[model samples]
Target chain A: MRGAVLHAPGDVRIEQLPDPAIVEPTDAIVRLSATCVCGSDLWPYRGINEVTEPTPIGHEYCGVVEEVGPGVSSVRPGQFVIGSFIASDNTCPHCRAGYQSACAHKVGMTGAQAELLRVPHADGTLVATPDDPDPELLPSLLTLSDVMGTGWFAAVAAGVRPGMTVAVVGDGAVGLLGVLSARRMGAERIIAMSRHEPRQKLATEFGATDVVPERGDDAVARIHDLTDGVGADAVLECVGTGEAMTQAIRSTRAGGGVGFVGVPHGVSIPGGRLFATMVRLHGGPAPVRRFLPDLIDATLRGEIDPGRVFDLDLPLDEVAEGYRAMDERRAIKAYLRP
Target chain B: MRGAVLHAPGDVRIEQLPDPAIVEPTDAIVRLSATCVCGSDLWPYRGINEVTEPTPIGHEYCGVVEEVGPGVSSVRPGQFVIGSFIASDNTCPHCRAGYQSACAHKVGMTGAQAELLRVPHADGTLVATPDDPDPELLPSLLTLSDVMGTGWFAAVAAGVRPGMTVAVVGDGAVGLLGVLSARRMGAERIIAMSRHEPRQKLATEFGATDVVPERGDDAVARIHDLTDGVGADAVLECVGTGEAMTQAIRSTRAGGGVGFVGVPHGVSIPGGRLFATMVRLHGGPAPVRRFLPDLIDATLRGEIDPGRVFDLDLPLDEVAEGYRAMDERRAIKAYLRP
Candidate 1:
């Protein structure tokens, strides 16, 4: 099998690797039908996350089960399925409470940017589709494994409800999906903060009622102006920068909520400021598994086309180009056909 | 009128001051029946909070209305009332949403240690008692103005529910009252982190099921151990220190909630750590006014005695001694009879 590995910062290469094998009774091996480069993958490529050795990359996947261990009875071989970045037993208290990422005995699924991937706790981690998805629906299904699910989690965590006004503070694929999620959750208005024209267009298409191209304090002021200075009822911090987080907090009404899903970097939240803001804060590595079933159904029903996030695609062998294009913002998301 | 003034750090003095009169159309003059030194007051007396000049102090009060402006119709002279530290118009969207402390027209009440104090937005800020309280209940009612209300906010913000375990990370008057709030809210178990015997006794009296004397990491570990390594379901952070905040976050189970209400000084929360914790964060000045009516009812019916937190009492003329006693930790809280 061939897979992508990061030997050093800014260095990704495709090389022959041993195929994954199920060592646990609850594990299953799947032949990946679709996988993609994540924005978080850029952390290492941009030299933010240290890569000491050849590290297996990718954690999202949509695939067909090829084999199953003795204990795997719910999902059979040849079934189409999608799983989350974090694999969990799903029966634990945390998983039961819809926080699978923090589930007891949870495993971070990695090395999915390959032909085959081994999944643990298969019964709990992988959700089989009612039927095999259409070829065109694969891209959207793959997104349910991470980005789409994360965006949905962000909107839900922000307490978006019918008739509420929501504000999203990032223009990435997840941010765009957040607009969709908020809209689907019955939000009457959505403000997408984006400076990029292409991303802004997608945001608007996805249900952003207003677009604020400004950034930082100006963005907060503009949002306030748009909402009559009461600020948005729900603010989603899709970008983890300090400025983005601050804007998200400031653009929310005093008693509103902030759902921050961006992987934070160099962000030091002043406790005093958070205390004074009086806004509710909820975020983290989204428990994508919690929302995977609903997202998958949405995709299957053609209610949403999250696949639009993937603008560029390449063979697994051309993984380097996929990273490069995404790193330079030339692609909203890059899909890798294995 | 006599009031407490901070001439310098550690130099609280009793000074003659002009009687306050209704200035705003919505203002009401109150003859303070009880005022108390708060934990936050020590911040300025200890020079942590800058005392630039002779600043009038004290913000917590339970009193009898002395006079009312022409526009003040809800409250009148001879009526007993309890008000929040921050006066609010309670008409703005924020106030209507139960975040009165963050109301657009919020005003921080001061000089409550004086014989007479002027309360702004009296119609919104002051909640009248059903009837005059017995002198024995005066101390408890005084706490509802700030400390007790703040503690209740912490518990509610932390999402304490029936059958859940709650951990309180502070031994101050507010933390002790948080134990009471958690118990009244139906928390099955309440852990009070404290080393002070007096505070611990108060905590027990207020319904703390356990007292962990350890601080910092040890305290977090102890809480986890108590909860079978799952951590408490809700953690209240009542101390404004990095260690206390960290412990509060660490002592909560994944997907748990943390309510931090202490006036943070130099605390900077690392976003990454908070993101990894997957805990909900909510805190602030505490819309104390939202809970005033309930607290006032409970007090009148003799359901709770938060006034037990006040271990010492002094006359208004001994205001300096009141500050000294609280600053020296000789008194958990100092009550001034104005």
Candidate 2:
């Protein structure tokens, strides 16, 4: 099977790799119908996060269960499914509390940017759809595996409520989906911070009531200006940079919450300022497993079209091109057909 | 009037000062029934926090309203009242949201260590009691002004729910009160981290089921051992030091919550570690004004005795001794009677 591998910074290759097979009784072998590049992949590709060795890339997928091990029961062969980035045994205390990403027996599923993948904790991690989703819904379903779930977590963490105004920082795929998630959660208004025209347009389509084409202090000021200096009731920090984190904190009202889903790099939360601002902070890895069922239903019902984030789609052989397109921001996101 | 003035580091003097007058129409003059030295006060006294000027200290008090300006209506002369350290105009958006400490028009109500103190935004800041309380309840009632309210906020912010295990980092007045607050909020087990025998005893009395006399990594390890390696469900960080903050985060289970109410001096939250821990974090100066009415009711009903934190008592002229005792940890807290 062909899989994408990062041999070095900016060096992504589509090369022959061993097809994944179930290694545990609870595991399942999935034939990926759709997979995609992630913003987080850029962390190592751009040489920001250290990549020690040639690493298997991608952690999101919409796939079909080709085979299930003896212990697999919730899902079986030929069923369409979406799973969390962090594979979790959902029966644990943390998983039961809707924090499956921190499940007691959790494992991060990687190498999904391939034709076949082995998923551990299949019964607890993978949620089967009522039927095979139509191809038109592939991108959206694929997002349920990570990006969309993360966006939903961001919204939930930010406490975006009905009749509340929310602000989203970052114009990446997660940020765009965050706007959709906020709207779905009944947020009255959403102000998306985006400097790119295409992302701003997508943000608007995703239900952003306003778009502030600014960064750092300027972005914060625009949010304040938009909200009568009170800032948004909930601010989603979808970018992991220090500037974005600080802006997100500043763009929230005194009692507002910040749901930061971005993989932080060099961010440092200044305790004094945070205390003075009195903004509530909650975030971390998205407990994607918890939101998978609802998000899947929403997608199946056509209530949201998160797949719009994937502007470029390519064959698995051109996975490097997909990574480059996303790296240059030419595509909001890239979808790879396996 | 006499007030405690900090002429320099380690020098707290009770000096004769001009009596306070209503500087604004919303101001009220209060004859303090009780004022106390706070753990935060020791910050400047120990020269940890810069005191550039001869600052009139003390920001916690419960007193009788002696005179009110024409604009004051919610509170009147001869009424017994309790207010927050931060005086807020309750009409502000933040105040309306129950985050009065972040009110747009807010002022720190200092100089309460003096015989009489002038309070601004009296209508919004002060919550009048039904009647004068018996002297036995004075200590607990005084705590409502800051420490008790802050502790309550910590428990609440930490999302302390029924049947949850809560760990409190810090053994000061606020930390002791946090154990009480967590118990009242239905936390099944409370762990107070303190090495001081007196503080540990008080912690037990205040509902701490376990007293972990460990600090830093030791504390984190002990908490893990207690919770079967899962850590506490909620952690209340009442100490402002970086070590305490780190320990609080480490002592909480993944996807747990950390409510930190310490007035941070030189603390910086390392985003990477926090992100990895996946702990929900919320904190700030307690919106005491929001909790005042309920707390006052509870105190009036003799439900809690947070005033047990005040282990030393001195006349208003001995305010210096009060500061000294707290600075030296000879007292958990000091009460100054004017």
Model 2's chain B TM-score? 0.98
Off by over 4 Å in 2: none
lDDT of 1 by residue, B1-338 (tens): 88988878899888999999879899999999999898998999999988898999999998899999999989999999999999999999889989999999999988887888999999999999878889999999999999999999999999999999999999889899999999999999999999999998889988999999998888888998999778899999999888888999899987799999999988888888889988888998989999999999998899999998988888888988888888788988998988
Once model 1 is optimally superposed onto the true structure by TM-score, how far is the C-alpha of residue B272 displaced, in angstroms? 0.5
Question: What DockQ does candidate 1 have relative to the true complex?
Answer: 0.82
Clashes of 2: 2
Cα-based lDDT for every prediction:
0.92, 0.91
Report fnat in order of the candidates.
0.89, 0.79
Scanning candidate 2 chain A in windows of ten residues, the lowest lDDT window is A91-100
DockQ leader: 1
Off by over 4 Å in 1: none
TM of each candidate vs. truth: 0.98, 0.98
